[model samples]
Target: MFTEISADEHDRQLELHGPLTAAVRRLVEAGISTGADSETIRQAQLAVEAIAETLEQQRHDGPRTMRHAVTGRPVVLADPVIGVRNAIAPPLTVQHTESGRCWTEFTLGAPYEGPPGRVHGGICALVLDHILGEVASDGLRQPRFTGTLTLKYLRATPLGRLRAEAWVERIEGIKAFARGQILDDEGVTVEAEGIFIAPAWAREAG
Candidate 1:
């Protein structure tokens, strides 16, 4: 179910995978937006397919959780919104606080747009969901899954550098109540609140 590795090993793994992820991230945006001719697009497509085939041959057996032995927390290498090793992630770096708050500042480009020049509402939801979940889990010391999430879009979120924050408003026995928001340069764009539930296994461990 999981792989336990030393801190150095994890660092080495990142070194091996980070460059590829970064390259693919650029490739995705370029592939979507390039005004290249058919010939040029054909060449690029061939190159990308070759690269994907090579990597696919070396893929891991299946989904495997990699946990850090020293930190006692699973390494976030493949999270869709924040995974450094995942091409789809904007790779937002979340800063967690002792005060039960978490925030991240990140940039979104043309790929994340929905309405003209605006960030997709769903993308905003994804970012806030992960941020609030992090707050509820307390950095995974207490495993909590999102039970319910509600969002209010005050205005359109522009696609560029943005900041989002979430914090625990209160907690019941097994449910944690949290609220969060996303902001652009001007002000807050989306407001979110969620309930997260700790499963029986987590409670037993606690």
Candidate 2:
């Protein structure tokens, strides 16, 4: 489930595609926030269509789980949460991972808004799920899938800079237990706990 690429080749991939992905992220935000007139919006649509077509001219048969040569860590370019190439991701990235813990600092903008200025509840869950799941998986050394995840939204999460972290509480046989929380400047806004399990295939492989 991982595609390993050499350091030089991975850098090449980023150099070629990183800028385009950044532009796409900006475009996505613009699409949600832009107040362009109808004609301008229509023209923009055509231009975006052209860009998509250009990129589609050459394509991978399908997306796959991958790793960056720089980090040598798993990367899912199309992942909805932390995927480097996915425009829709609030684009969370782990800033720290060690001692059975993982953490990240990120901002959720207009595109992720809910309840006027609050971050979407579902989005918060998504963020926690990814972190908790990753921690429970032990950075994929012993990969596991989410068996259950529970979140408690302690307060309305704002649409701006925030921090999230998760850590492995314990592991029992094929299951790993993890806990995580989300915080803003004021402090904890969400708390989460999850159970991650090694699937039958993964258990057998191990």
Candidate 3:
């Protein structure tokens, strides 16, 4: 089941309490103390990663998500799509919905820091792709996945909390077009364009 953790708790674990580093240290200690097989140590380490991922999801202020960190398997709960919807960094939450369009909002935090208190470019891509894909999936019998993406970093996205939004712009046959933007308290920092495609397998499934 999915559970939420307060922002304070997340900070304590990731920053103050140092749960992640502590876990890795423990794995090293175990290896030295017991000379355990490499596989055993790896499995234990994987479990720790799972726990951390689950906790991170609980802390994100977006759609709820949970997964087996070790196997990268979704922890099925309310809706199957909910986990995917929430797993992306700065996970998004639906703010508005209507025919041919969907809207969402979310925040980014220190955990996503790239270069001394700024959001990473890869993370920015993840945010844009998720929202664009979500909007593109709205009316299609077969949902879309990113086929190509183009981005422009107009300015640096500051660390701490920030807002982002995306919407579908057009659709032609199996291709979908979408645009997205990231903003801090100051204003817009990044813009994106994406091309999404409905895969043949998905069409068959639908």
lDDT winner: 1
- Runs in model 1 with CA error above 4 Å? none
Locate the minimum summed-lDDT window of 10 residues in model 3. 80-89
lDDT of 3 by residue, 1-206 (tens): 33455555443434743444445445444544576688987887798789879878865454333434343332322232222222222434545355555555565555566887788888877777766776776622246888999999998887767666778888888888888887888888989999999989777776
| Pick by TM-score: 1 or 2, better one | 1
- For each candidate, what TM-score against the reference? 0.94, 0.92, 0.57
RMSD in angstroms between candidate 2 and the native structure over all alpha carbons: 1.8
Clashes of each: 0, 0, 0
Q: Name the regions of candidate 2 deviating beyond 4 angstroms.
A: 67-72
- List the pairs of residues colliding in candidate 2: none
What lDDT tens digits, residue by residue, belong to model 1 across residues 92-177? 88898777689999999988999999999999999999999988988766789999999999999998999999999999989999
What lDDT would each prediction earn against the true structure? 0.89, 0.85, 0.63
Residue 151 in candidate 2, Cα distance off native in Å? 0.6
lDDT comparing candidate 3 with the true structure: 0.63
Off by over 4 Å in 3: 1-88, 139-141
Candidate 3: residue 101 Cα off by (Å): 3.9
